[model samples]
Target chain A: MISDTAVESDTAVETQRGLVEIYSTTKSFHGNTVLKDVSVCVKPGSVTALIGPSGSGKSTLLRCINGLEPIDSGVLKVNGEHVGVVERSDGFYSLNRKKRALQRVSVGLVFQHFNLFDNFTALENVAIAPMQVLKRSKSEAYETARSYLDRVGMLERADHYPSQLSGGQQQRVAIARCLAMKPDVLLFDEPTSALDPELVGEVLDVIRKVSASGKTMVLSTHEIGFARQIADQVVFLDEGRVCEAGPVEQVLDNPREARTQKFLERVFG
Target chain B: MAQHPADLMESINKPRITRKTKTEKTAWIVLAVVAVLIVHTLISNPNFEWATVGRYFFGFPVLKGLLLTIILTIVSMALGTLIGLVLAVLKIMNITPITILVDLYLTFFRGTPILVQLIFWFNIAALFPDLFLGIPFTDIGWGINVNAIMTPLVAAVIGLSLNEGAYTAENIRGGFLSVGKGQLEAADSLGFSEWTKITRIIIPQSLPTIIPATGNRLIGMFKETTLVSVLGVADLLQSVQLIYSRNYETIPLLIVACLWYLIITLALSYPQKKIEDRYSKHKNSGGKVTATTEGVKLG
Candidate 1:
């Protein structure tokens, strides 16, 4: 159903479930520019893979989408509201810390390093944010967390602390943590990059299941084959710029840009 | 290829024990002689006055002083730690004016001797004859006489807590820094409010680093309460001095005080070890195993 609507025309989608649009967004750290005038429109319920070499701004773009990294220029809109920035009658102004925190509730991010809260059990890590930020009752929040953990096949390890679990188990729990929030857009910054070879399958399988659930996902990854299989649209970023972006088959199978072609050959060949 | 159990046991016989070297023997002899001499001196010394020490060890005045010392340590350390948490948060937030203010407070309290601080507080009446509690440079507030409010006991508590707060703040700041940047970022991405992030995420992970150092501070605070004796707070040391002065039995009274301190110090150490072990349990079980997973190849 989603792909049928997506194929008809991207613009005709529901405004309430509209595309996550990034327009001319740029970001920098200190004096070094990390993302330079990047733009992409990710359709709701579609999986968008951002592929690039090291320091190619792929991770930066993923961070910018979820308001973890503030853009220096242009706008990022999730559903319809501008992320990290509030538009007032006078002009645009960055949201204050509290307001920004509230705005972030609609987006969830999975990190490369699987940064689970060390002191908490897997269940507590998933349950805490909903109880604290969303004001859900303790029982209800924990129930929701357990359901998400079940979805990610991590229910058995719910009581284990992050350090006690395997890396892939931790990442599965991390994914479950994001899912527990019921976010509109799920952003993964190389989620599988930190897992073991045998363990990588477990986390990827979880992400694949999450994607099938119709939550919009934007991920930056070095997994060429995985991206080719799951992504509806693939964007190749190089040197803080989007060198190529289009349908997954066109971009991954028959890339038009030299940089994209070279990246693919180096990874897939 | 299987062998009899008896034959296997015989084949795996343990190596013979070796004799102690000359240096090891000499060290043992020295330690034995020192132990004997110390015990002999303590038992035989006429100046020790074993009866007086035994009587005064659980006597009314010394017992009262011990109770006071315990109270002072608990109250001051609790108040100081609370203030230290606030100062640590302020410093970590990096608000320039507040950070500078915290730094100045830390430097002033930490740089000066505890004895001097106690004395200064006891004489606060000289610095501010009238204490005001309202807007500065305005006559809109009421004033109170300082001498009535700044009693020696109050002054002692104020001095000890302020000094302890500075040290605790530095330790807490170190704890906060020891938490990885990725952990903070993870918390932020989870939509954790700043308060939730600090209370739930940062402080808990930082505990392993902070607890051991804070334990050291707690014991130090217990010992440092003796400084309040200079202000006539009638603490353990002060109580001993009072008795010694009255009866001219200084050595036995001093021994009583030393024995009490040694006993309390030993008592505090057990809890500290338990807390350290509780926080560090994960270190032995899980962290190293995942690190080796980095080299595992994935397609």
Candidate 2:
């Protein structure tokens, strides 16, 4: 039976602040450990950037947060709801579509490729979650989609399909799609890394605006300058572990970890 | 446009025949052969039985059987497609025993011949005198009986639908697999549930891949209906077989069924082609397909 309270519970959980927390999260794929014994927290109104090099497990960390990738062991809680796992060896017991979708709404995610549904126009793509999954009426979803598109300055391109738009336009539409769901925390897994060099600025600009609007965002990005500008805290990941995590200025300016020093030198030497 | 092969060899030293010249030469050759056959047949056989041909062409049994064949084909295909979709989804899921059970179904249906399966279903009363679906030792409440209700039409539907289900599952699975995993992940992150992911994003995008296979299956199913004549179901082929066994005119009776099948096939194929053309708008045209599709095979 479908319940009318799913959206209402989700909204209530999201409305309460300082509720998202992760404790001792660890993940592996094909018996190879990717994120090992990871623990992180996102405050209600803070921007945290996960910065690292190739194969540093930054993307894995982000995916674990959303339960898209299963974690081998962990107790990750988003808005007081457990995700990814209930027990270490036994695995997740209550991992149903309902709970997974509920977690997705609370923590909206964007991928490296702007994986917008190419079959739908931008407006339909934006309206999808609200109307279909969240059970909002069509008109209500469309109005919200319009507002989010306007927020990303993509209102003009709402009628175009993802294939018809440029790389930056598609990414912005993806952002608008996340926004339409009104997630408490937005997770980006190298969102701008897939864009062309010329198109990068347009997408980073939208993220910058979202950050300025006080949306709590956790991003894994190689854009050093954007991180310096927008991030409140930057966590440096190296070989499936958090090497250095602190104030953006402290980590960028004075790294206590030798590996962080080496990474910063490689990025900004 | 009017270039002849003998004259064309003199104009340009191109060894390959010009398009118009080749067409004209082929046309003349075909016309000459047809004319010779017509003259020879006319001269040899004066009484060719044109009246018999006319009577069989407008025969009542043939017409009625054609309609019955079409109805069976439509009903069976529609039923098969629906059951196949459910089985395909069940096969793809992570539930341990269900996936295994669905795989077993695919294997048995796909590996066995359709005619054998039909015959086996028809002869089911002998094998399982008492129908039940419970554990071997435990008399549980999880079974249904087989003796009383497995009617001939029911058995035919069961046979056709089960056989087609296996092939449809493969087609649907292929279509689902062709859509990138990123699309599902993206829909996942968008807060779309599993069902929503399928109905909204995956299915719509996969339409381009699934529709062609589905149309092909529909055509195959249409012909597979003739296999039901073995069950004595009075479908088109059986109806014609009934009449021709008496008259002893095998060719004319076969011709009547053949013409009806051809007409139905052509009618269905027009819409199938239109659908193929519609969904094929985004297909990668740089590569080649077999001659069965809108492509050519050199060998």
Candidate 3:
């Protein structure tokens, strides 16, 4: 009876899908603030692109959403569940390691450098999290891993190690690794920035496929043109705060804020 | 068309050799002569007693001593590597008190001579005559004599294992340090548990760095086992000493010991090379890994 109730609550939580809401989130490293009072509402199935210059805290904000790094102050919620912290009547308490890992089930992060495990084949890389964390059967996980690899066009190179693959191929495998987990929201940190000029298109093409599939994705990117084409919402961050965020067209083309206009001129000019 | 063959050959140009090239050829000839002379002196020396060495090479006592040496090296290395792995992880974990404790252990064991440590362990009864096997600070306990339990062979194994653990810990720590920080961040971002991160990601990648150093240590440990002869334990060196003492053929027995050591080390080298090659195969071609991460900015 208790197990049945637990399953019911789990499904109930799944059904009540909510927007990813960041409420006045502040994050710092040592004495310096990387994200100061940053808040953004990402509706379900929307693709948001975070754009700014180097040290503009775009990556940090993406990291905060996935619970990879913690916020010093404020609540970050995904589908109405607090991320990385739990708030009580008295105060907020940080989640433990296991709880934080559980929170990560709702989100997946793809790194700019495609940090695939060097010793593992592309298939093993994708299958590991499912077998280890999700406790899925080996065959089941491998089947899911293979399907995701096929989706990313890495099925042919499934047995290749990361060192044996090109940067574009490795990044596609990395995307498959994230997709295999079946997370609700996907976060990409400069996914194509680390690729060679000719190779960038292959990775961006995969990301475009994922974007069109309507998965909630937040990507920090330097590619203004790609961002303009894909992102439903464009967030322009300067220093540690969000400068201007709205429809991608207005934020990227004609911005009201002087900082946003200046940044766009410098980047798109 | 009808010119003589010699005249035709002279018509074609010949490459010139400079004085520097002639000197380089002479240098190679001189090195070859020196190497051949050294080989000749060693092989042609009659006093080496090749007959006695061949007879005693597979002799019972010498074979027994060789077996003991092999066992000691294997056992001590296993113990040392296990302890070293634990110490390396503890140091990296940075638990202040435990890190300081491990530091003291490394300093004391690595700082002193291995021979001295062997002697110290052999006479450990002087420091603690009785060892209790019960709860600490409790009156209810059973005590046993330390001297009775500590044999010469046991003392040697303990000494070698403790000393090797200190060096192995540093090697392992260096291995872990050689792994890029981006690897750790990627594992963390994937939400792998700390245990999974270390076992799956960190240790596997650290193998290329760790395996070669470990192979060197294994070879050193094999030779270092001879130090146990100082304790009157009948290891390879001591067995040779016993045979020479009985027959007064000291140099021959010494030659026998050297030959055995050479054979064992040569045997070990093959597998070591195979292991190194296996781990390094995947690492040779990867382009620049992620650039050294930018330090987190501080106000």
Candidate 4:
């Protein structure tokens, strides 16, 4: 166990694997319903791919579970903790504005746009969150960041800005950025769809490596091949509903719903 | 060497790639005409009292005017920039009824003439001489010096700053918004608090926009500072006015102030334009592309 593996620190200790439970989650933006009666549980150490056409509520579902997008009516539980936005039935959310802010730190989301701070180099982007938000020591954060970056094959590009990297490289850094947080669940909102045709695979390789590491991941992706390869469960989304879902092979390849069948026929063709 | 006369002639007649814009051509032509008219007028007018114009520059009254103008410009521009920064933050946060009121304040100040605001603030003491700023529904009061605060220079700074603040707020808000809604989410997902996101993430990303907007404010503030002379701030323009009025050499005395303003504007224009170009460089094709962390690998 001590074969030049260095020391396990606080971040290694803070990783608490937990289950996510959702019941009848619904969300809307400015009176337009984006997700309705959507229910899905992302179990610990499983890859769940939320697949759908554009505006099919895949991203919205991910957004709602993390409390990034406020839901109209829903009960979402992450690590057995309710990720509720407004006043709770037991009055937990009504603590104050400061507490509400504290609640947002638990869920980690990797945006499709890579949203890496362009001004900060890739390493600083990963480094700042741990050092500041988690109050981790600078050396500790940097050490974890280096490991995360090395895992994503971005340890060399740490000093480069987001602007200087290719699309594939940026998303890899984004994965490292999220992994640095060591959250209960890591949500990916169309992580690979925005990438160039050629660059998608390189980023997908990093995600697959992450999958093999047993990190719980909920990805919204257009890369059907990657989903079939990695996702334990594939939820086919259409018209803001879970049209069909099961194992990746069952749902993506041989879907039950007519909408899903039609979607893949078009997508696969 | 091999009878390339036709090709050389074609290259010579090739339409200019970096052709002068309509505005550039117009500016050049207008400048040339104005220069010609000035030279022609000077040549024909032998009896013009040019020496009197030089004489007004040395007078004590004109010196006071010059001092006032410089002071007004410095004070108004400084106050305006600070007010603008505060207003920008307030506008970007959750919009309440009070925010709407602030929006209205911005619109009214930006819409109206600066001269009018200067006059109104200067004369506000006539409407409410007893001013107080303290907790509501309490006898404990804080009296304010109405006359001291209402001095023309003070009023000018207040008016310019308040009015300019609104525009600055819009500029700052624009910069904040340009950082993209997704960028804020990225910051939040990273566990950055609201203030941290704005200062560290949002502000840094929006700098390309903020820089040019602030530069615009710098130039606008410079010009708007002259408006304070309406309240007897003795800014450069007002100083020029007093001198030209006392003496009959109106054109040349006004030209002195004009030359100074021109020089200052020209000096600022190059750097401002350069900064604007630098911020916009990313938009051009040559620079490296930045993708949002949404898993997109933008070229």
Candidate 5:
């Protein structure tokens, strides 16, 4: 279906800037193919939610998109530039560590377990990357960090370390940390999965605000309701394949694939 | 409405009661008695030659020797730490040839005894009479006379630092490993260069694990400096030996040296503990509170 759309709208692809384009990407660990020929296109300033069961390749697809995990075959590009690999005259060549790291500057990722730097306070956690990676002045980075922390409603607790904050607060700070980087694309892999049930809403609310700000985002989530509320497009995966892809209503409410239907029914029930 | 809620709350809010263990009192008494006995022995024993200890404790020669010992400890530890950090980073980088080289260095330095190392370093002039100080594989540098430069003091510093570097490297490597894999992934996602990631993230986060172990190594290093006395470098112990050999007051001068070591060790321990406490504060208070006053609700 994605290839069919690509064929139909080849001209449209050129105009779309700062978009994530994953075409027939295959990733495997050992003998197990975790992501099999997955194609996901995240348009500029839009949220695409990937919903699937555990071990259904949602996380793997997100990781591959950000170049955190290398794909076995196929092209994975963020903001129209290849991530983790470069195309040569002969074939695709995996980039060296330094070049790959430079390519990752355009993309950001939020993990399920909020991986905030424990040694730094919440504000420093958000600010350090901008200062170090972007070569921003300390004051400029801190100001940007304060603004993002305010956006996440964590401004007052900016002085606290990750250990002192609850799971929900840590995730909010993690989101703010990613935002401070000012990447063209953001990927969230089950951002709320490791959070306590009651704490999930605060993080989701912050994400909802981010989505409204019109940043390009791709999130793999188990929260069906939250995904439906925020995502412009929804992609459903089953056993390493994208089973269905369309508008949120079509995928969540009127899924055509039997697998997506079964999965949604089980999730909704 | 039989009783007021305030009274009921007061009744339940009494101070916590804990039973005192009878064995603790017994142990305290035993400890006090043992301490008194030791003090009495030190004061009353004529063999101690307390006057001689006092006379030489602050003597010029002893003070000079003490200064050298302190210098050796500080210089060797600082050099060793620098070497350890470089080696640890190289090991983490995992370039096969460099790793093997680091492994060989660690094995040679740590496997041999310090005494032997000191002696060997003092005699290194025998093996290499002259050393070059410039570009390798080409005659582009000045030649250094090994015999002229390799003094007892230099040999002691080199021997102690090399051995300490091996141990410090292991400690620092453990510290780096103690950091969670998640931290590195987060840094990677932010497009941090390898140097930035290690310097800004890995090193800072590993401090809580590194600081306490490094403190232990530091205190050990202070005591280990005494071993250099055998090389006749006139450190604290060597000074005491010189005096005792002249005056025939071995036990008294030895007591003086022992007293100075104890006092300095105690002094070093205080700051070591303070640094360890500062670094590990987060670990102690983690999960004890929430970001907001909603802590009560969360509970």
Candidate 6:
């Protein structure tokens, strides 16, 4: 476990890895708002956990940071570059599909369903994006893929297809696929939410190993204990609003807001 | 836990009791008798002319017609599939003008009879005697006589291919629609370009659905080529017609054509089954295959 003092000292030195800034971001679907005037800052080399109820917009916020879902109104910036929209002299203009896709190369998202290509083997799933999107040579992409699979302890099953693997094994491969892109920011949306109770530990173990490398990560999860152990900054959201945001100890141990305390009590007790 | 190991072993080793299945035995005997009776009647009937059927089975005119029929089936199916793939993609794009144009093409081809279409193409020279190759509304162009090019063979190919294209387009569009939305989102999140997404993710995922349907179309096209004989093309059926017309051995010549069609259909069916088996292996595991194999049994 990383001590809070060490995380603060590491944040002291600024690096251009993954810097996410969301300002008054609002999103809705069919006139029903999901994220209402939400603002959260995730500094580089820090793991920020968005802990909230099911409909509290944690997943939507993570998706907006990766440009998976477009925001209705507000500014979203990652590493000083606007995401999903471009700012002009007049106002912000939505980026075209092609341009938005190009911007997504630096951001990686791990879905709750694993979403591995059913036609591809584990190694192919990890290697395909590098070969297709980045235009890497076949040998080089395979080599990078093997290294990541090895990191996630999935190298032995590289030739196996998605259906051949269990949920935990598949999520580990999904993580390797995300890491193979070398994205500066990683977003995990309930990585273990779909796994069996016995399988959750394996995926969380891989996530813990990833956090030790000091990569920028934002994950929405229901596991409050795991969030306390891994997240440096914790943001508690309720009713599509951030009720409390601070250091892990401040938010989890000593929540300032009544909603945050109530949520923690319900989750813990 | 209550039973002794010796009693368990003895029970497991005993011969299993089986039912007689009396109805199944009776059905098998009845079917065998009916089959034997049919064979006896066919052999005894003199008008059937089994010898004449054997004689013309490999006759020169029949062989030539078989070759032409095979050629027509292959060419038309290849052209039809290509056109179908393009139209399916355009329909999926859903741009108003392009989609409307594609729909109109599909409707017109599917709604009309292929025989009429073939005859129309055969007599197209009456409508337009010359075909001009140039930009629309431009005076600078060269002309080619339509009658020189619109032979019966050409007309048959065009009619069969265009009509076949409409059916395949709907089949392929169904295949495209069967792919899950999660696959597309995964492709998008990986920063895949539209072309890459379609070629790599969408097409590959939809293939298990497309292949079985396409196999049925191939076999149907083989039989459907018979429609071309009305245009005076020298396909298998036309060759048989020419021979029987000359010798007046209509029954035997028709038998020969039927046997050949059956043989070719059986031959094509083998490979289709093999490909379907290969694809179904993944289909069972992925659980994304919605294209039924019901048509395969018919083919």
Q: For each candidate, what is the lDDT?
A: 0.86, 0.79, 0.87, 0.76, 0.87, 0.89
- What's the residue-level lDDT of B113 in candidate 3? 94
Candidate 4 or 2, higher DockQ = 4
lDDT of 3 at A99: 85
- Model 4 agreement with the true structure over B1-299: per-residue lDDT tens digits: 34568879788777867888999999999999999999998778755546655666556766666566556566666676677777877777676976887788888988888788889999989988879888889978898979767887778777877887778778878877876677788887676777777667766666667777788778777776777766777777787887667765678777667666777788889999987776677645323224222232111
Give candidate 6's total backbone clashes. 0
Best DockQ among the predictions, by candidate number: 5
- The estimated TM-scores of all candidates read 0.89, 0.81, 0.86, 0.83, 0.86, 0.88
What's the ranking of the predictions by lDDT, best on top? 6, 5, 3, 1, 2, 4
Instruction: For candidate 3, state the interface root-mean-square deviation in angstroms to 1 decimal.
Output: 8.8
Cα error of candidate 1 at position A93, Å: 3.3
- What DockQ, on C-alphas, does every prediction get? 0.35, 0.32, 0.24, 0.35, 0.41, 0.31
What RMSD does each model have against the real structure?
Answer: 6.5, 7.9, 6.4, 7.1, 6.3, 6.9
TM-score computed on alpha carbons, candidate 2: 0.81
Task: Determine which window of 10 residues in candidate 3 chain A has minimal summed lDDT.
Answer: A10-19
Using TM-score as the measure, the top candidate is: 1
Residue-level lDDT tens digits of model 1 in B7-50: 78787676788999999999999999999999999889888899
Off by more than 4 A, model 2: A1-24, A87-94, A256-258, A265-269, B1-51, B126-154, B285-299
Comparing 3 with 4 on DockQ, the higher-scoring candidate is 4
Docking class of 5: acceptable
Which pairs of residues have clashing backbones in candidate 5? none
Question: Which CAPRI tier for candidate 6?
Answer: acceptable
> Number of the top candidate by lDDT?
6
Worst 10 residues of 4 chain A by lDDT: A4-13
Poorly placed runs, candidate 4 (over 4 Å): A1-17, A29-32, A86-97, A137-139, A252-266, B1-35, B46-48, B55-64, B132-142, B283-299
* Residue range A1-269, candidate 6, lDDT tens digits: 46885676456424545899899989998998999989999999899999999999988898888898988888888876789888889988989888888778888999999999876778988999999999998989999999999999999999887877999999999999999998889999999999999999999999999989988999999999999999999999888988899999999999999889999999998
Q: Which pairs clash (backbone N, Cα, C closer than 3 Å) in model 6?
A: none
* Per-residue lDDT of B278 in model 4: 66
Which runs in model 6 stand beyond 4 Å of their true positions? A1-17, A88-92, B1-14, B17-33, B136-142, B287-299
Candidate 1 Cα misplacement greater than 4 A, ranges: A1-18, A87-92, B1-11, B16-23, B134-143, B286-299
Report the candidate with higher TM-score, 1 versus 4: 1
